[model samples]
Target: MVRSNAYDLPTISVQGEIDHPRLRSLGFVDPSGHAQLVALGTSGIAYDVRIGDRAVGWAADHVEPGVSIRHSDVEANLALAYNSCVGNRAIVVSGRAQGAEGVVTGKHGGALPTDRLLVDFSPDVLDKLVIGDSILIRSRGQGLVLPDHPGVSVRNLDPNLLDRLPISEVGGVLSVGVAARIPARVMGSGIGMGSVALGDYDINLFDAQTVEEFGLDRLRLGDLVHLEDTDNRFGRSYRKGMSTIAVVAHSDSVLAGHGPGVVTLFSGSDEDLVAVDDPAANLADIWRV
Candidate 1:
């Protein structure tokens, strides 16, 4: 197991809140099948269209009901936001849920207020957790990589999580098993960003017919996805000879150009990329969270 010296990075506890401000989706309908006047502002539940019941969450990417985190130091907050990968452990350090253990199911970030982390716990744990409770994420996997493939750069990933995936070289190609393969062209909102660690990018699932055609509607929270013709080693950009793998971090949005947000996991050039179908390619299934 390739581990990091900072694997035991100081655990930081941040407070949670229901931070939803009034949002206006001018002249558009979200995936919820309605034009809403006011979006729900609360934590612990997702309000939007989702793929499967077994999915860890169904929260929308930008504006949805989920736990929100904020820190005074920008660097520490960014580190907390960037290094923490989905499926990583999150512990409740204070308030009603003190000593409770949970798994990071997803993360949503953009600007102020809407930025938040989504964690899934048992019903009992949820009942115990309250606003302002301390959620501590044991941050790790900041600069992850595939040692064998010097060409690939991994980010926002947990090495233990990566090792769990059954990766193999078949016929001289790196075949990665995923719940589904997404075309790079369909990726929208945050295309020209620098690096995948800072935040997550959304998949554009606006066209209902197109979504059904590509089978993108089957995407579930925590499912790993293979992005076609994309690269994110240095920064997220589109190139013919590039490829990237990311996780489904949040649910579909009503906002015009947003869908399930994906946090990067592995990225490399096309020569080293290959993807195949695996029905059980989800973090929830792999980690049994």
Candidate 2:
């Protein structure tokens, strides 16, 4: 078994409310220079979209599936983003959906006013949810460390989920199963950010050729993807022979330099962290949601 310091990690409570969807009056321009407007940004409860839904082909930009949540206060929202981890438990504390349970899925970070936390809930629960409903997240898993593999850094992943991952160690090398292996060149927006603790960077699918070659169109919202030659340790950057594993957080965008959002989960050198193809390597599949 892989050893970790997960047991020593402390869990905290962070509260947030369902965020309302946003749209700019001026609309947006796509990569082809076409001015267009559509449903975009964070939504209270995305009824048609869920963890296993297709991320591409959506008429939205940076659109979060399921429920998008954030604290009304800026500083508190920051805490909610930084402290919450994927696979953490979320509870609806107020509103018609009170007592409903969900799972923290991912975080949205980019050129936005605030970072939003994504949560996955059942359809019935989502139907009852409304904008501004309070949610209490049992946040944990920030300071996680693999005792045997010092080169690998873990971020934004819950300890319980970590234990259930399709991970195996052989000859001091950790092999992690992922849904897709994305090239580093496709990474865009939020690229130069100095922190991976909260939010996410984009996966650029603007190039049709690259998209076909990578089969990126098939990418789903909860899929685990490996970023080749990427380093998200301190910030997002290209480091030779490095690898970063991240989860697809939000849907595709019509704008340039932006596509589906992916939040960092693990980072290290290719020698230390190897990616293995596993089609079922998705959060939705793992959790059977």
Each model's TM-score? 0.81, 0.97
Worst 10 residues of 2 by lDDT: 107-116
Question: Model 1 lDDT vs. the true structure?
Answer: 0.65
Model 1 bad stretches (over 4 Å): 1-36, 41-66, 72-75, 112-114, 170-173
Residue lDDT tens for model 1, 1-289: 3333435445444444323343455345556667644333324444332223322223333432235454545655565666676656777788777888876655666553345666666667766656566778766666665545666676776556667775776544566788888887788876787757766788888766767777887777678888888888887788888888887766666566677788887888777766678888887678674
Query: On a 0 to 100 scale, what is the lDDT of residue 127 in model 1?
Result: 64
Tell me the alpha-carbon RMSD of every candidate.
4.1, 1.2
At residue 22, candidate 2 shows an lDDT of 67
- Candidates in order have lDDT scores of 0.65, 0.90
